[model samples]
Target chain A: MYGDQGFTIFDLQLWAEGLGITFGVFLSSSILGLIFGSIIGLIRYYNIIGIGRVLMLGSEFLKNSPVLVQLFLVYFGIPALFTIDLSPVEAAIITLSGNTAAFIAVIVISSIDAIDKKQLEAARSFALSEWQILRLIIYPQSLAFAMPMFVSLAINQLQVTSLVSVIGVVDLTRVGDIINQRTFEPFIVWPIIGVTYFVLAKLVERIGARLEQRFSVHQASSEI
Target chain B: MLDPAVMMEYMPAFWDGFIVTAEVSILSIIGSFIIGLLIALLRISENKVCRFAALFYVDIFRNIPFLVLIFFAYYGLPEVGIYIDAFWTGCFTLSIAVAAYVAETIRAGIQNIDKGIIEAAKSFGFKRVQIYTKIILPIAITSSIRPLGSVFINLILTTSILSAITLGELTSASKIIASTTFRPFEVYMFLVIFYGVLTFALSAVIAGWHKYLNRYNEA
Candidate 1:
């Protein structure tokens, strides 16, 4: 029925706008997730008082549960409970960031653990403060180790951004839904949206591979 | 604001929703595994067309959001006059989506198998089908039990998304409870914890099973 309506130029603008929103949300939340997750990881690594345990428990819940539920809780539930207004985009950002943080924290913790204890001890003996050791020793190595996992997590979180459409945020998926409803062309509409995501994921994989190659060059040369 | 007391009365409805979620999750898990196994085989097939087809399926399904897939199936199936209920639609979409991940994991497991074992099987005069069924599959499944378990756990978490299409699963059930009781916070808090505990328990079982399966190989 909608196929007869003919594709309008307006649909192109809507798709572009949707792509912008989706990428905007993904980039912002990813940055927030990295920062928040690293802090949580550091706290757990240092075994900071009772707060470490609390953060770990909270992160566990965040990681284990569905992001859709988390979105609903933050978007619909929280405002009702606290009597504060939260726009759909704001709620999506908060939930996605928290969800991404949980996964990122796990990656951070494991990557730090990959470092040799003896190396840390050696650094300490060299008069390196805890902060200095973390900055000069732990950060670089852990980042190299965490790069692949972080890349994969970023891709997954990008897909998770589609769920924001369910709560009325007009992201890429929502834009597809709008066009599909009006045009009633599931065959054409969905494939275009799916291809866009596929291309974006491929781009992420390409960038990640380049970074991985660059980081491993030192080890590659040393071995030879 | 609705009274908290009124919401307490809908516990039965919420429980019913929980039951539906559990049922759909269980059914879909089994369906995905069976389908995943076949797709996994196709992915590793000697025939180039089979391999390419499987790769295409996995790539497209994996890259696309599950919500879009579900919507397509939910809407598209009816347009073609193939009517099915919400539960089946949810299960079908989940199986298709999850099979992509399962195929990837299984392909990895199959690739990791030692060449020596296959040679030995050939030397024993085992037919190609027999070798796959009797040896390759068993080895691949055992080695991949842990990864497969996580994939299934993720599938369970994904079942919550089915609520969007009116499946009345856990999240949808809680949505109704939240609205009716005007206790969105309490309802959703309970749901988050419920899903967390469910997934945690599933992962623990998986970890236990992985340990058991690899007991002889332990360091």
Candidate 2:
């Protein structure tokens, strides 16, 4: 039922480019989120004077609110308020990273708490510095505990990358929008886009499962 | 640069948007719960077809983004001769999408039930339906109140996405206010805090109710 403006070979290129953008944005934001989120987690773990509480409160607001509103605040609000030019991609990265970081902080804290208090006491008796204790006794165990959560979060964050299309990011979803608009073929266009996302999510799930398995082994071996 | 004065003038608009959001959330919460319960039952049913069908539904809906699902429903529905407004479409799509999460939560609760209780019900000659309705559902639901609350809270947040189809819910309302006042930062910041507080308050209430309901177990 589509006319000459129907699907074209060029559409393949557009789809590929959209896929690249989606993956690129997802990777960068997830990495940034992990770093920042770990920092927040560490701060809370150490109980830094005043900064940890403030950061945790900020992260709570980030966690509780919708990412779309945060996107608008960073994309439209920040530029207007700060008089700085902000691109859609930049705003998306900032918002998604902050959001991911908020969740990550909680995961980190809980995983560390999962470690035994006795381990900490033993390390103290050995005259291990706080840094040494964290490095030796806490890091490996908490990481193994946190692996499954991180994997699920990674899968979640991948799906979240789709939201960038709303802000004119020309991501996969945006490409589908463009193609669907031109072709007036919602069924054909959306299913393709949806399948692409489905495959990606499944891929993440598979990879995450493998990593989870590896971490579980590491955790088991470390106990011995 | 931060202007409370502008926001105060726009409180009515925000309130109107909040009402729409509340309507969508409340309706979807009920819609999703019923649908989710059915799917949860289907997932654990003895029939292979029912089990696979329910699993497929959960997998597809959970794996895909809600935005994409809503877009499909919004645009694709009319082509097949189903005409609905943005509000109903939003509620319908949100119900189906969020129901996947709800089903999983409920299923976990169902599976976690003590096997001995089911055995006892069977020994008492309870019909399958009776066991499900009189025993299984009540226990599963009560135990899962907290997870379901988070799921519903997430449903409330997902309503903002309906704006893409022009539903004019809270997020959409704030979008309009931001453009009109030319103060997106303040508008969105207020919206963020507004949603944050709403969710926090709701979660706190859910926790209390959960504790109250499970007081017997605690004792």
Candidate 3:
């Protein structure tokens, strides 16, 4: 009986709108996360001032805690504490970005460590500046090492984006919840929502594979 | 302004929620390990149908968000006349969903076992079941203790999502307390630290156990 109410042209629009919001938030938060996380990673790598220890502790807490609690803290707690206006979407962005950044910082730090110390010393002996050494020696190798971890993290973070719906951002999962409630069709609605996420994940995997291939070409050439 | 009086009043409710979280997590860890081992065996089975079925299960469960799976089990199971309470539903869904991840990890551990060991077991006239139970499973378990522990820790964190389905777990109980006391910040911040410390402590224990298990292998 509920199936009779299901297939409308407006549903397509709703799906599109939801997909747009999901991708929009995912893309923006990922970029912001990468930038912020990389900076933190670099700071830690350089052991800058006394702030790196604090940043490390902060990020460790962020990583260890569940994202749902983080979402609640951002969505409900922050506004209550600060007496400021924050929309659900804003809270979603803030929480997801922070979550993504925490993971990214870990990835960046590990990848940087993977670079050979001997190579760095050799570059220094040749009188390369710190920026030049980083650019010429560290960036390429660390990027290669970090690519796979970044890809996996990106995929995980994409799924985590679904949690944002709980805070009332009308992302794909929230859209599915809304439609399912109205139509009472959990089976159909949730499957559609789940498949959209699966496809997005697959897309990320494919792109990451391509990048890994492209970056690993240097190793291939050297071997030949 | 800080309200010590309100937090003090809600401490009992928070403690109750913490106990429920611990109970659910412990049960689901055991449940998932058993189910995951079975699925991992099925995945490595010679029968094509069994392998395909295992793959299908893992693909579907791993791709779908845990929240959606919980919703489906919580609501759809009741529709199908399989009436169960939130705690059971939470445990069941968690076991089934997390088993996929655990299965994959175990499969990796199994595959990493040296083929020479299997050959030696076969040469010694060990039956297939004996070999699996004796040589293969033990090796996989020892090597996989660390990864499996992390997976279980993640499963514990995921149990918090069960709160959405009315499971009165830590997060849900804290939500109620926070709304009642209008101390959202303190409540959630405390919840976050609570989870962090819980997981951190579990990982430390796991690391110690892992080191102890692998001590003979170390030089």
Candidate that scores best on TM-score: 2
> What digit string (tens of lDDT, one per residue) describes model 1 on residues B59-119?
8888888988888888778878889999999989998899899889998999999999999
Runs of candidate 3 with Cα error greater than 4 angstroms are A1-7, A218-224, B2-6
> Fnat for model 2?
0.82
Ranking by TM-score: 2, 3, 1
TM-score of candidate 3 chain B vs. the reference? 0.96
- Candidate 1 lDDT, tens digit per residue, A3-116? 557579999999999999999999999999999999999999999885988998999999899899999889988898789999999999999999999999999999999887
| Chain A TM-score from candidate 2 | 0.95
Query: Which pairs of residues have clashing backbones in candidate 1?
Result: none
Quote model 3's iRMS: 1.2
What's the C-alpha lDDT at position B19 in model 1? 96
True contacts kept of each: 0.73, 0.82, 0.62
Candidate 1 docking class: medium
What lDDT score belongs to each candidate, Candidate 1 first?
A: 0.88, 0.92, 0.87
Model 2 residue runs over 4 Å out of place are A1-4, A221-224
Candidate 3 pairs with clashing backbones: none
